[model samples]
Structures are given as C-alpha cells and as structure tokens.
Target: MKFTYKIDEKTELKMLDLQESEQLFYLTIGSKETLREWLPFIDFTQKVTDTQNFIQSTMKQYSENNGFQAGIWYEGKMAGVIGFHKIDWNNKSTSIGYWLSNDYVGLGLMTKSVKAFIDYAIKDINLNRVEIRAAIGNKKSRAIPERLGFTEEGCVREAEWLYDHYVDHVVYGMLAKDWLNKNKIKRV
Candidate 1:
C-alpha cells in the first residue's frame, strides 16, 4: 500500500516476457486494455470497477494502507490480477488474493507467481504469515497454496459472498519460518 514499492516497469515487462514462456500474464493498475482482457472472469465482476476507478482507488488504497498489488501478465499481455490485502505491519500478516483469465488456465503460472510474491513478502518485507483463501469448490484456486507448501488450515463457512449467494472458503497459510526452511533446500 505504500505506492513506493513499485516493481520496476522495465523489470515487470521482462517478468511478463518470462511469464509468457510459462503462459503467465499481468496488467498495470490502470490499463484499460488489460482490465478489459480480465473482465470475463467471475472474480473481476465482484469488486473491480472500470479501469479509471480501479486504478485510482487501488493506488490510493496501496498508498494509504501500505499494501501490495500487481498485475498478472501472460503471453505478453495482462491476463489477471493479484495482491495482498489487509496487510498488518503490527501483526506481520496479510491475506493474498488472485484471479487468472481463463485463457491462462492449465499452466502453473499462478504457483510460480505465488512463490515469487511470498518470497518478497517474507524475506523483503519481513512479514510473518501470508494467508490465502479460496472459494469452496475452486480446486484450481486452492492449488497454488497446496503447491507452495501452505498448510490447509480448514474452511470458514459462509465467509464470502461471491457471484451470488454466500460461499464457504478454504484457508491456507505459510509462516516465515517455514518459508525460510524451504529456501534452504531450494538453494541447495
């Protein structure tokens, strides 16, 4: 949310290029063309306004709240969105959310992005816990956490209302210590 923590546009472009090899995608905060590509997804309909509103509001929230948000770039284009919500510096915790356009499905791009973001949050920001919650029945949504070594902490019944009626959510979490340990192995 600091607005100061920008991933360099050039680097972001390069990341998008690398992501293309893996079928990942991203969009800048206010890119109408990018958001347009994401609109067909059910998740975007819930909270996203138009390009102007989303960019203005999200930038404001990131500045005011000290949070992080980024576009998911895939195939050299913006294909999705991801961010850390409800960041608490005092508590050292935050919730993560993401959505991918259907065009980018069936690849492990989300998992790679999640791992990259988790590394940034824990190692760079010094956060303790990163949490992820997926709507019930969203197996693909939950798969990122499962692949990233997050614990399946259980479900919260009727926790979020999306698309229509209320829906249960499956929670997943990874602690800083666990991530550090995992890194040692990966480094080796």
Candidate 2:
C-alpha cells in the first residue's frame, strides 16, 4: 500500500522505497558536514546501499507495527527525512527524528513537517506522548520542537556520541492532552 501524508501543497511525507535510495544518499552527501554535527548515524551512511538498507529496515518496522521513517519531499524533490522511532505502545509514546538537506533550511519546512507528525501521533494513532531530543548546541534542530510548543523537560548529560565526543541533549515533550488543548482540539 502507498503511504503518504501531505503537510501542505508544497511538502509531503512518503515512506522511502529502495528505488529512492539514491536520491536520499545524494541528499545526505550534500549535507554531510552539517548533518554530521548533530546526527550520529551520518557516518554510517557512506553509500547508497546503506540508504537502501535503512529503507528496508523501516519497511520492516512498518510491517511489525513499530514505526516508519518517511522522506520529506518538497515540491517533488527529496529534501529530507522525518520519522517516528520505535513506538512504546504500552505507554502510548514515541519520539520523532528528522533532518533536512542544508539547501532546504530556513524555509519553515521542518516546522510544518513536524506539526504534521505531531498531529498524526496524537490524533491519528491515539498516542499519548511525543518527544524530541536534540543536541544542545544544535539550535536549528531544537527549534522545531520548541516552535511546536513542546515542553523542555530536561537535559540528558552526554546523551549521544556524535563522532569523537559526546553531546548532551535537551529533551522536549508534548502530551496528547496538552497538544490537543494548545490546538483547541476536543476529544469526543
């Protein structure tokens, strides 16, 4: 089945398939230096086949009801990827991960895309909580969750290994009730 979610007329999220792996690889290549600063897995993706393997794994995640990663297409071009990490069903919670090509920054694209994911997690999937964690020094990445009104829960000291060193993360969380209330959505 086809999986697509439109964030707006100019942007949409589509589940990645093997055929689009090359495009994704190129996007990563173009943004490598910048992406590597905040994302730990960038070094692991040194080839197109790595991207394909990622897609295949995400497909498995979808089939197993874990969660899926999706390509963020902007005006029909592969701009980035955003996805829910493996879900904690018992807790009705999940986290989101995203990266945009350096070329696509500052266009309000990530903000819009994240809003859509939050809506899906809360309204579509009946999830109770959504969280985002970003390296403390990565302002741009942290802004998405902040702009979307997620609460700054706290910090995890040296939470991730970037490449050679550790980077602390600022945790942001949004509960379904708070998100719905903020959006003025009432549950039936």
The candidate maximizing TM-score is: 2
Q: Stretches of candidate 2 above 4 Å error?
A: 186-188
True-structure RMSD, every candidate: 7.1, 1.2
lDDT of 2 by residue, 1-188 (tens): 65789888899999888899999999999999999888888899999999889999999999999989989999999999999998999999999999999999988989988998888889888999999999999999899998899999999999998789999999999999999989998543
Q: For each candidate, what TM-score against the reference?
A: 0.73, 0.97
lDDT of each: 0.63, 0.92
lDDT of 2 at 74: 92
lDDT of 1 by residue, 1-188 (tens): 13222333421212122223222312322333433332233335333244435555556656676665666655546656677776898999988877656566666667766776787788877889999998777777888999888999999998876545677889999999899898763321
**Which 10-residue span in candidate 2 carries the lowest summed lDDT?**
179-188
Q: Model 2: clashing residue pairs?
A: none
What's the lDDT of the predicted structure labeled candidate 1? 0.63
Clashes of 1: 12
